[model samples]
Target: MTSTPPHQSVLDKPFVLDLFAGPGGLDVAGHRLGIPSLGIEWDKQACLTRYAAGLETLHADVSAVRRDSFESLPPEINVLAGGPPCQTYSVAGRGAGRQALEDVKGYIKRLMAGESDAEIDKKLMRLSDPRTALVLEPLRYAIQATRSPNRGHRPYDVIVLEQVPAVEALWERYAEVLQDTGLPDGTKYNVVVDVLKTETYGVPQTRSRAVLIARREGLGDAPSLPDPTHRAYEAKEWNRRNGGIAAAPVTQQTLYDVDAPEPRRRPTEDARLEHWTSMGDALAEPVGIKHRGRKAPFLVRSNYGSSGIPGRRGVRTDRQPATTVTGRISRFVVFEHLGHDVVCEGPRFSMNEAGMLQSFPPDYPWSGTAQAQQVGNAVPPLFGAHLLSAALGLPAPAAEAMREPWVPAAEEQRAKLRSHGCGAADGCTARCPRPV
Candidate 1:
């Protein structure tokens, strides 16, 4: 659910191309930044959600769509953003999934060696999981876009990709390929890859994602990643690494034991870094029907009646950030208060609250029946906004800008702050914001 940013560098790119676009999170962020965008999503359910929310989307399996078809679009369309499905690459599913990585890499190598799609698919079909190969779609688009047969189209100006941390090595591989490959006009890209924690950027959940940003080569200097604004855990690492000196020390962050009688964290060292919002803040107003079965009183997944430790099954008290809002968000039970014994129904997060945590409109017009899956799969539009802001060549935004709900720009408000004027023969304009 990562991608978005702040800035000294504002986006000059007029539009973004979101591939494997899930529920329009990236597009939502792009719209807020005055960048018009569209998404290509394969899932009918997510596309239904996209249409209900009034976000633009094209329904098609990203893998089934040919990259050459993109040549039909106007050359002005440039920034590319997407998060390919990561279930196969996620650490949570790593037992059989991890063991398949080597085989997956082998398949990718064959495809790289110019094997026919039919040939590779035949072999991949034999793997325990073929989804692992889907990770290469983004790279396929990047490589193809950078070397389009059409003479007039320019390569993508910026590329933003996100996935679970275990797939970072794949992004790093793509970065290497982008570095080594260039356009017919000698245009190349400067790429940066890193694993980021969404909570560090004001997300209520502590989800971690591997993010990649690639800017067309010779855009003055290389692209920089966005800086963090909120303080949850160790603002010091950010401050020291980025040469930032804050007025006060960062507040400590800790989660309370679900079964503990008292809170588990230390007192704040002043409130400067407490901007990290909690499950309490986002879910303050609940709208979903609470489950009220006394027999299954606030039970969490798998360990409904265990006395071992609450950590086995997280407590849904608002004291801490909610556990990663996975499909599992619906399995946990809620308590009325931090130390109260009262039990509340169903899941810890409603689909609306989950959307809010991911920086979507709380009441976004949702179209699908798999509410938790749709909510769990989105990038926080606020976070995507930050990543897009950085990709557009702006400096990281102050944390305060991210603390509240994101407000998008009007269509008429679109304006370019290019350092270099438009229609230049060389196509150079942006000034890179140094990475923090």
Candidate 2:
């Protein structure tokens, strides 16, 4: 394993080391914020996509890297962030992690008591699904970085971890341990944990994630989750009087409205948030027009039934935020309707459109198989920017700045591939011929 130092221009910037990085979502957010980042991903296809996006990457299993006590990790990295795979904890898959939650907490206690990795691995191998043990990998890295004398003695100033909502209990446990263990400088970490609603952060999709943010007490003020920038979405009756096209909800109150409004004025915090973005708002411009021929209104119908009941599929109109975009997003169907009649129907969302709903740029280069799965598994870059900003004690980026499109230059992509010992023909692996 090898690690590359940050470029001279960015050497002074806060560097982020992302583990279990799937196709560089948080890294993209870091790039936009002028922070430097490197991602460690084991999936070959995801690594290919990361290289195409010109993001720095180390393609290796996190456990293998952890074995070396992450010695190859760059000394300049000050921020640690990752979203562990959540299949076992997700409702869509077998609930192995959820069933073994109590046991996992025991493992955390053992780690705190200074148990060897080999001992833990021997027990973890007895689990029905070994992936359940991966959740502790980040905590292990944190403990070693802070307590190991061989390490440069420079602990990460900020630590961020995210997973499925089912893992919120685990995050609570993490917060307790992190705050309990003070650094050698006599400063401890201040931590906060919450399950954030994606729509509240301006994402045009309705999804929830368990997030944990920790900041070293010596590093300025304590950290908290960023304030909501958008109102939460609520299900309202669709108005059939206007062909089922519901009126857009009011986002804020103007001075005139506040003075003469029949409705009571909302509190200051409520008045500050904008309306939750709807699916139509995100896909209306080019995706709807290009794919469906008109931007009027559409309904997305799930192909699979819920909870093993056939013909019990769910549906969402364009007026509402999209239901969670998942790996099986391609199986959904979109229909254009006129009152009581169905005018036309087409394939649901294009990959680009799916990315947009997740708050990725419209032109983000997606080059991997199971692309939808990658997008679904990733943290929305918009949400990540806010989290990163709050964790690092930096001002949140402007809403417009978060929406801006970005693409790497041709030369930049070539240089990134070369740095990873990959070329167009080499396909981004160790056995590939070195660039001349």
Candidate 3:
């Protein structure tokens, strides 16, 4: 008799269906928590990475599944999670989605009013970018699963959605509709919507995302956002107002040793939370140099503009959290911070170091082209765990678990790559396995 794997055997009810699931970031969190999940991604490269990571995935466009009203989905799925494409909505890209925000809201009203899909698609195609309409796909799935007779009429117990900060208004619209249109069983959804700082959740990168969570009212108390377990990054105060220059070498003092006077704490400041994690904390072993038996700090210089100022690159000491990891990661340069005003340029961050900063495992099997872009697009698994725990009404994982090293399922493959001294960075021409 053959035995089932641990992840498959533990798959009972409350499965998650993730849409636009690039590289399975949220799915990784679900797997670690013993929850079953399947992701649907249109990108072949992302699908390759997902398969390599042993994640369940449907290699197809989300619109294809929407045509069947999600009839192909597993009946046991009771949770809906998605992070839709944010290119048009992001500040780095053209402001197509941002400009069409009002039109998108109008489309939501149309969806709520029982408009036909053909009619909606026709109107959506006229927008600046048709992909912007995908932001509404989650609502379409939710409506089908809950109200459509063709589907099994199984209502999702919890719904979670996240996107760029520009999508906050859209999520607010989601909250209003989800609450107004209660479940078929007469129980409304209790919803919460807000922008969350990833650094506060122990991600060693400073990034923010808009999040919306809704739970069926009859299940229990209303869902709430997870309390931050780490302090928020205060760059100005921490930098001692040095005009964005490093105050001192990282090896000499702790991250909190600032020369400036202490500023008043914000309302969200909690005495119990720990200090925000820094790049030194996340990439100490891989990126730090050995100096007199102790780890020495480094500097990362951004070629892009700092805070919307063109041509002014940003520099951060390893003692501070890394700036938002973006698709343009090649533009970042690393330098060894030699004491007494000496500096030496070094190799850029390896794939492992970049992923580690984003709270992914150091050994995560990144496959396909543009791996850095995949890492940048993913939700930090550590942050997702806290969000999932809150939405499911489960006890949060221990804070220490965030720092625990993770070994990917495909250890043999990783071992082979390490043997070849291939660090999986750009310009590497290793004969490693690519997705077939």
Candidate 4:
């Protein structure tokens, strides 16, 4: 049995039930807002990390957890947030999404029409791949609770979901289904879909996610989208369509480059936004000022291996934003561009750097095993913080943590952490600017 979290008062506290919760990203945001949260995750490694972080957990898979389980919860659980495993729908993966999604949608429609499991099982073939349909589990909870005779007890006040852009339409379809199938009183939910660019928020990575929000308050309780606090890209005019409340653009720059002059580059189609926090920013330590970017290499290329394997673009820690972090999270093998014989400087960018780029705290208690898989799959906590705030109709606050843990007293304590390379020590020097 899961231990119930201590509640000071149940009258007005916001409770979050996170399904498919990966290392408690949304849960961290909830805690910061004074909300109590519980996560249901299947991976033992990820659950270990969550437990280490002092979060409540039901170490079980959402697909296996029966619908009756939701009714077992105390009334305080008013908000439900989830980001189902996204590998099958990710662009990087061998996306069998076209066939998988159509089949899954057909299964959902049949289930809604009161078809028996045996009947649907016989019709659906890709049951072998579990990731395709885990998404429907959330909708099942909503519809079953909405149809319950207990009118005094509301199913939920709000529901928020985030996933890869490939799964956007499925979630939008879910919003449509919930609105169409109303409660006994005919009161429907207010739902909206927003595709968010993570850099627009504050994380250093240029990743994009599809977000869906549904509110079950009275009709007038429809929540407004969380306004952007920083300008990530240039906008012609300040309008919601151009990615919400725009501020000065925060473009890509490394922690080493923080003291350097601003970047000068030709504008893109949408006009580039502002300087996003860099992976280097998270690695900066208060050692006496270290040697900064000096001309080490004019051009570089990375991800070199077998001839059949396509090369992954090299990244400059000083300026260019990193590509999305994946489950494997390989180090980009750095090479100098002299046009004939390339010199290998060895790859920088450690697992901790990847996690930091994902906006996990430098000291976050990552379960110390399967480090690459754990960080790659986990949502960035800072990004999750903004989304949860937006769903609640309260404006999302700016990132609240300092760049790196700094003690005003002395530089004696080195940031104790694990990484693929010696992180941010004084001796090593490397540079990567955007290739022209």
Give me the overall lDDT of model 3: 0.73
Give the per-residue lDDT of model 1 (tens digit) for 1-436: 1224322343454578888788877887766565677777766567656655556555666765543355644456677789988787776665455677667666556655556666876786787766776777775665556556562545677889998888777777777656774433456689899988777677776778889998877765788887776655443443344333222111111122233332223475334444566655555554323311112112223233335554444333353455567665565554332234433344454566667666665556556677778777888777787788777776443333333333332222211211111112222222211112
TM-score of each: 0.72, 0.83, 0.83, 0.71
Residues 1-436 of candidate 2: C-alpha lDDT, one tens digit per residue = 1112222321246788898989887987787777888888877777767877778887777887778637767777888899998999998789999998889999988887778889988998988888898999888777667754555666777898989999999999988878985543344689999999988888998888999999876677778898888887654423332222323211122111212211222464488787888887877765322233236466666644466542455666666688788888777767665444435665667777778888877667777698988888788888888888778766765555544555543765546664662434345555332323
Q: What CA root-mean-square deviation does each model show from the true structure?
A: 11.7, 7.2, 7.1, 11.7
Q: What's the C-alpha lDDT at position 382 in model 3?
A: 80
**Model 1 misplaced regions, further than 4 Å:** 1-11, 72-74, 94-97, 103-126, 147-153, 181-187, 234-274, 285-311, 337-348, 395-436
Model 4 stretches astray by more than 4 angstroms: 1-11, 111-128, 147-153, 183-187, 217-220, 233-274, 286-312, 334-348, 402-436
Give the worst 10-residue stretch by lDDT in candidate 2: 249-258
- Give candidate 4's error at residue 92 in angstroms: 1.7
The residue-by-residue lDDT of candidate 4 on 154-220, one tens digit each, is 5677888888998888877776655775533454678888678776677766678888888875634
Q: Cα lDDT of all candidates, in order? A: 0.60, 0.72, 0.73, 0.58
Write model 3 residue lDDT over 303-391, tens digit each, in one string.
Answer: 55566552366677777788998776766877774566656776788766777778876666678899889988888888887787788
User: What is the model-wide C-alpha lDDT for candidate 2?
Assistant: 0.72
Give the worst 10-residue stretch by lDDT in candidate 3.
Answer: 1-10
Residue 290 deviation, candidate 1, in Å?
15
